[model samples]
Target: MGYIAPESPISDYDRDVVFFEGDLEELDFEVLQKGMELGFILEQRQTKTGDIEWVARDVRKFVAPPEKKVIPIPTSTKSKANPESPVNIYPSSYRTFLEKLSDSLKSIEKINDSGNFEDAVFSLLRLLGIHSVYQYSRDAQAGKADGFFILENLAVMYDCTLRNPFEEYKKDQIENYIHKLSNKSQLTIETRKADGGRGSKTLQIQGKSRQVWIITKGNTRELLVYDSIKVKEVAIKDLITITIEHCRELSYDAEHLSSKLVMLGD
Candidate 1:
């Protein structure tokens, strides 16, 4: 929520990068504190074009991350960026932004659900480079995989737990749905192969890879999820591939239980 102004008697890094920008500046101190505790230094300023540019002041608070990064770029707005080219982010700015967004998604604020959900998701997807609509959700239908992705020949179904009060999703329910999809998809291939289906060779696999993603119900607040994904994992010194928040029942909305995919792209 707090960003370091490069010239605010802070430093001469010209790193005036607003990593954790947005309405998050008005977010509660505790929520911001929780983010910092999760090892998300949300307001890091990366010196993209200068020497003696940046320096790490300290390790105020850190915590283990529990969800995917959610980066929010205004699609309705225009940028100097090229649509055909990849999106570029300064290291510091990206890291903090993701942390907040991911946390917001996990907490499921009503804000995210408002307006166009697809636009928000798609915007983040483009940031993640995991494009393609693998599954679509008919929110009225429960126990069904709402949305998914077909990445690298593998399909991932998600029962998005992104909802209000920040509650932990029921693992059993998640497991049940994903298992069903895995089995159903596998069976279709088997039955088809036996019936002389066209792509028998492609379908003849011992098991298909399945990824079960759990996004959130909705959020109206500024989410810094995109800021988190780019953080460095201690053990690997590399950014974590998957982050899981601690499972606890913070809060819930029964109606918005499952409705999105968790995309993992190579």
Candidate 2:
């Protein structure tokens, strides 16, 4: 019903106060009276030109809307695979190995050996049908990745952490890995003994769909910062679930798991 006068120079009034002109309609007058009754202070001032102005003070403060809660997707149980599905077939030894790995990961906190954790993760990936997986040597140069695997067109460089609460050094290691990725097109990594014991191999990663991930048995909320850099943090339990699903039906291979990781990050 009233307007903030354009010609009302702010310099002519006190800070946090707005000047309004024109007649207040019935509804507007009622609202103003109710506001004053609710402790809002209103003042009237006469300008040098005899113009009457209304100054409203002590207006309501702005309150921000509450943040939306993010509910994590619960991990699902493995479903029965079709007997006719060719992918459902696997060797007895492979099934035994999967069982053992899954058991070890369940009590990961009890395992003081980081090497065992890393090995279990690497073996699990291989068993999941990713043929191009390689584990990096512990003696490799600084800023080197712990391991990497190729999933069809996607290449993922990853590091493993056994810390339950997730330490800062692990995060620093991931940042270093990101920096390494940014600087190099090809990464030289040692070949695993299972892959013919080759001395070393150069992975050409430039122009490929690349992702950096931290496979940790720790809290993953800390890794949210890397989401913008295409980094994913997978909890140890989730990895075990993925492995179980794969072992059951050959459902989640490296490419499928990588895509699932992207979804989890989002």
Worst 10 residues of 2 by lDDT: 19-28
Query: How does candidate 2 score on lDDT?
Result: 0.60
- RMSD (Cα, Å) for all candidates, in order, is 21.3, 24.2
In the range 32-105, model 1's lDDT, one tens digit per residue, is 54224322222333255633322323323444445545445566553557533434453445546667756655
Window of ten residues with lowest summed lDDT in model 1: 230-239
**lDDT tens per residue, model 2, 9-63:** 3433433334232333222433454223222234556678985455654443224
Error of 2 at 141 (Å): 6.0
Q: Top model by lDDT, which number? A: 2
Runs in model 2 deviating more than 4 A are: 1-110, 140-143, 192-198, 219-228, 250-255
Q: List clashing residue pairs in candidate 2.
A: none
Best by TM-score: 2
